[model samples]
Target: MENEISSKSTYRLLYRVKPFLAITFLQFGFAGMDVFSKVALNQGVSNYVLVVYRHAIATAVIAPFAVILDKKVRPKMTFSIFTKLMLLSLLEPVIDQNLYYFGLKYTTATFAAAMYNILPAITFLMACVFGLEKVTLKSIHSQAKVVGTVATVAGAMLMTLVKGPVIELIWTKGRNNQGVKGGGTNIHDSIKGSLMITVGCFSWACFIILQAITLKTYPAELSLTAWICLLGTAQGTIVALVMERGKTSVWSIHWDTKFLAALYSGIVCSGLAYYIQGVVMKDRGPVFVTAFNPLSMIIVAVMSSFILAEQMYLGRVIGAIVIVAGLYFVVWGKSKEYKSGSPSTDGQMVQDKQMTDTSSDSNENSTPEVITLNVSSRGGATRDEQINRQSDQLLV
Candidate 1:
């Protein structure tokens, strides 16, 4: 019993921390995506074109995994659900990619990351408004969630609006003094870039909320992911075909560091990372999956400094601090709430409990004796104690 209790408690603690970790890793992962992608795109790979190629390659890679372990998958081939998954793919991969790349044209990488700090707060509000998530102020955990979200948003605003000191650059004359000299992507451009990326971030946030519902009908996350990526690939290809079909030379192959970067991103970043994320989502849930965005920010910040020499301005530092503080509150609030209200045997939710009786069937027919129990939290204020019906638990 004590072992069971300890395991259950540990699970609960992990669950509470899940969101923070998910968002952190996501942020870091995307940081790599942002920097590498910009380099590739600069060499004439439009974001649209890159996403098209990436989705196609990723779907091809994921195909073998999905096909090999077909038995363990769930949701068993339904057309209606397939349609929904495809639609979601359009929302996240297609629309989101367009916004992101378009924004990148105008914004610096650091500025984009700074604005994106608002995503978690935006997601929470969107989820609640859409009836996809429930929030309450009755519990300290819920309140903490609220407070953290607010602070994070405020920090994003700070980073977005404040201008940092500009650095001067001396560029070698390019044939006739053309091509990137003396000034960076201007402050105005950064603001514009920040705005566009913020829109993209919110679009992604919407996708996160939709994920919970998507998982219910399409339990095979890998299968659903394959469909989504395939659909997204189709969409991106269509867009590319329409736009870059004439300038096909711009999209020509060049085996260089950029090509290697794209290959890594397509195969490992988009392909493998996405699959693993879904697997974790199945076990951990959506909030757990998305909570790791902050880690990406820190990673990106360090990378941008060494790789791009982007300055760590006071604004960005303050924003990072604020966002991290918010992350702490959200995690803490969830943990405290889970402890107080979530069902427990001395603060641990029950696992499989069987109630067996040794009485004769005749005497037990009219009276109840033993019952079964299973427990999970619904993130409510009340101490949620759910007693579900059992298959063969005996009475008396």
Candidate 2:
């Protein structure tokens, strides 16, 4: 009886911490991608080629599952949905990723990772502009979101403009000179890279917003992901062919870091991360998933220092801290906003809760379940609710 009781307690504990463990592992996976991609870039992989190959591999890895699993509830694709899929492909996989890789080429992985923390702030601003986010001056949570966005932008600016003395760690201490020479320490390159990364963040923010819009019509998560990957692969190839016109050698892959980078990022980050986050988000909320994003930055900073001998700057450390604080404030505000029970918000929440309960019931009965927006009643859901739901889906 005691053994059985202990087993039940253990199971309960595992159930409770499962999300945390999964998210932490995802952070580590993302951190490894940054490190590996950097190594591949250093070894002469073209950023454009990398983008194309990455999505191709991702499509291949994810397509079969999408076909087999999402067959029952996959929405019929319309011209509008197809158009949005193309734009989505253009935004993230082609533009954002190529720019991001170029930025990563010119900057350290740690810096690129740190700069990505501004994504939520950018998304919030875009949502406000589109009227998908209601900002009440009287609400503390609204105030928090505005203040947090400002702080995040300020932190990003500081990171861009300031370059303080390097803070050497045990791994990077003795090789300070080598690190300084090898790292992206040049002022011009730093500024250029920072611009690219910031622009990429904006593009990524746009992608998130548009994805939310797209999900209203096409709601099968796996199928939609496969479509994005497949379309992105095609679009990225065209861009790569144009950009890498004369460099046929850049397309060549061998049993090397470049191939591994593409393989790992496609399989782990793009493919598996999507499914895992979706599963976790179904249990917890989207906010819970996004709350762990900064963990990837922290992990990247540590791993880059140890593996790549990347040097940290005082300005960067300070900027990273401020950005994390701002991120926390924004996430806290969002959580509160969701909990605030205004009529429309409450209605949406109740509907979502009912959907979740229904899905849970189906799962218990060993039936495949897919959560989809009721197209007939789509007009009833407010833009804010739609955006919130999209945020939940795309953030994965």
Candidate 3:
């Protein structure tokens, strides 16, 4: 009995922390992708071609599971959903990814990862613009989010504009600078890379927002991920061909870091990450899904210093610290907002149940109905509406 009780306790604990573990593992995978992708790019792998190959591999790996597991749950694909999928592919797989690779080429992996820390801020801003987020000035949580967004942007600028003295680590100390200039040494390259990454973040934010919107009509995470990868592969191939033109050699693959990088990034970052994030977003919402980006930045900073002999600066460190602080503010505010709203949500659910019961009693022949609670008073639907829609669909 004691053993069984202990096993149940363990299971409950794992269930409670599952999302945390999943997102943390995702950060490790993303950090590895940054490091390996940097190495592969250094070894003459074309960023355009890399994007194509990555999506191709992702499609191949993810399609089968999507076909089998999501067969029943997958919604009928409409032209609207198809169009959204195309745009989704374009945003992340083609535009955002290409720009990110170009930025990574100009900047160190650590810098690029640090720059990505602003993703939640970008996502929050976009959500607000789209009416998916409510910004009430009187709310303390809203105030925290606004201040956090500003702090995040300021930190990004500091990281981009200021390159202080190098803070050498034991791994990077006394090492030959490996023919690679520190990201901050060249002002022009830093500006160029920073611009590309910042723009890429916007594209990424758009992708995430659209993804949440798309999931309303198409709720199958696996199938949706497969479609995105397959469509992205097609779109990315066209972009690669145009960019590489006559440079067929850029497509060549060998048993080296280049091929390994493509394989790892495809399966881990593109395929698994998309599916996992989609699942998490259904429950926690988009902002929650992006809140953990700083974890990957921290991982990349340490891994790059040890593995790539990348030099870190005091300014970058300070910026990273500030970014992390801003990220937590956003997360804490979101959490508090959710907690404060839970009682209302519960009350709404009970009211919905009472209405359903009343309708059933009034008409004996009436079929059970699914109630979609539009919790947001704003003009646009929030993630709560999406969740309610998904639940309604499941009931049907």
Candidate 4:
């Protein structure tokens, strides 16, 4: 009886902090990747080769797990879903990641991360245009989201355009003065790099919109992620071969920092990060997932300062604070909206029981679907079971 009580308390604690923990893990992992990738890029590793190796490793690791974990209830693959996955591969690892890494090669990691703060606004606009989001200006929730988006945009621009006084950090300055040299972030290169990251953000927004739609058809998160990695590996390999054609030296990987970059990024940033995101999106919503992106900016900024001895300007600090404020506003609005609009516990319990019945009766000749996915819902139905039931309904 005592043991059972302990276990229940642990479960309750974990459930309460899951969202915070997930986003925190993601930001730290991503920040580490940024630092490692920068070091590899500085060591003259080709961006295309980095992409190929990263995705290849991600595919290998994720595929077996996906197959094993999702085998029982995994939906059969269709040509249509495969086509959409292919497009997703092209959008993310191909266009978005390629541009992002290349831009990272030229700019400071802090700046590169700050540029990504614009993604929420870009995604919000795309969602509105695609009819996925319904915006009522009269609603405080909607207004908060809109204003937060605008603030995020303003913060990004401020960081990009305005370079102010450097905030003195004694540790970074003293350490750097002792013969350590930071990477160059020249004005001209910074401009070019910023533009690339901006475009990458646009591609990422498109990817999110498409991924949401695709999840309606292909509800198997792990399976979908594995497919994306596999296809992305192929696409990245083709790009790498084309770019490094006749240059055998570019393909060489020593058991050094470059190799570590590929391995760590493949396992953590690509495979695990994407999987965590899929789970988070299914539990919460996309806005909630993206709302934590600004946290990454903060993480990267602090990490870059300590690791690279990178200078922090007043503008960057001020802008990052603004971005974080905006992020909280957006999250607050989303939370309020979810609470106000979401169904009560009794209704959710009824739906959960209905879904359980539908899933038990489901068979192969079914289309998968998911509906009303909310983080705050206190239903007994698990996310996967919910998706399974939705898939069963699709068949009808």
Q: What is the alpha-carbon lDDT of model 4 when measured against the actual structure?
A: 0.76
lDDT of candidate 4 over 213-282, digit per residue (tens)? 6766666788888988899999998988988899889888989999999999988888887778766655
TM-score of each: 0.76, 0.79, 0.83, 0.84
Q: Write down the lDDT that model 3 would get.
A: 0.78
Ranking by TM-score: 4, 3, 2, 1
Q: Report the Cα lDDT for residue 20, model 3.
A: 67
Better of 1 and 3 by TM-score: 3
lDDT of 2 at 43: 77
Single out the weakest 10-residue window by summed lDDT for candidate 1.
387-396
Rank list by lDDT:
3, 4, 2, 1
Expressed as tens digits, the lDDT of each residue in 258-362 for candidate 2 is 999999988887777755655554443343454556667778988888888877788877877877787677667755665443332212332454476577778
Which stretches of model 2 miss by more than 4 angstroms?
A: 1-26, 176-182, 273-292, 340-396
Note the Cα lDDT for every prediction shown: 0.62, 0.72, 0.78, 0.76
**Model 3 reaches what TM-score against the true structure?**
0.83
Count clashing residue pairs per candidate.
Answer: 17, 0, 0, 2
Residue 355 CA displacement from its true place in model 3, Å: 13
Clashes of 2: 0
Q: Comparing 2 and 3 by TM-score, which wins?
A: 3
Model 4 spans with C-alpha error above 4 angstroms? 1-16, 174-184, 342-396
**Roughly what TM-score does model 1 have, to 2 decimal places?**
0.76
